[model samples]
Target: MMKRIALLWNVVKGDARVLWHALRQPERPVWLVPATALVALYALDPFNIAMPLAGVVDDGIIVPLLLHVMVRCLPAHMRRA
Candidate 1:
């Protein structure tokens, strides 16, 4: 059990390093534009700030989509086993 935990931790650490590098690259992610727009919309909106839809979307769709997009956007070398 300890060995499995160690292995899982190592994998998570390595994957996080790769993701950090990919996201920190000079090139902006494709989703950044849309994400920024969404943020701006939220920021600019004054009435009815209770955004249940946004919370639901982010929790369900956006989170997974963002993760998928991030992995896809990684450099081939970084993603290589």
Candidate 2:
């Protein structure tokens, strides 16, 4: 029973390490972009602002623009051939 638990723990740790390494690689810039956007949004505090422009800029413009860019940037293999 103890050996089985140790094996399972090691397997989980190995998988986490693999994911960490993948996120660190240069080819995965998309992962970093979303995180930066989130940080910017938080710093801006769009919700508390009294103006409609803030909501429009954050939710209406930036969010959809980011989604559009992400959709276009998806790998060719992900799209129907």
Candidate 3:
């Protein structure tokens, strides 16, 4: 129904606002994380480095590990928010 759609829209909007606020926190150093992660990921990529397990190592482990490091690099306060 229209009412259900409206409620869903409201919930999604609120969640977005919360995420926007979190991303804007002064102490977060937001851009630094992804930029560094990208560089690190590229350097450590198996194929780029001529490793034999290029696909599996890069996709299965390195990518996720880089993402986790990126998230961890964000300020604690921003993450808590």
Task: Note each model's CA RMSD in angstroms.
Answer: 7.7, 13.2, 10.2
* Residue clash pairs of candidate 2: none
lDDT of each: 0.55, 0.51, 0.56
Q: How should the candidates be ordered by TM-score, best one leading? A: 1, 3, 2
TM-score of each predicted structure versus truth: 0.42, 0.35, 0.40
- Score residue 34 of candidate 3 by CA lDDT: 61
**Taking the tens digit of each residue's C-alpha lDDT, what string does model 2 give over 11-81?**
54453344345445566557645654664575467573777676655554454444445434545433222
Deviation of model 1 at 56, angstroms:
22
Residue 57, candidate 1: C-alpha displacement in angstroms: 24
Q: Give the poorly placed runs of model 1, Cα more than 4 Å off.
A: 31-73
Cα lDDT for residue 63, model 3? 48
Off by over 4 Å in 3: 1-53
lDDT of 3 by residue, 1-81 (tens): 789758755654454444455556665575864665565567566575566666654554554454455555656665455
Q: Which candidate is the best by lDDT?
A: 3
Error of 2 at 23 (Å): 13
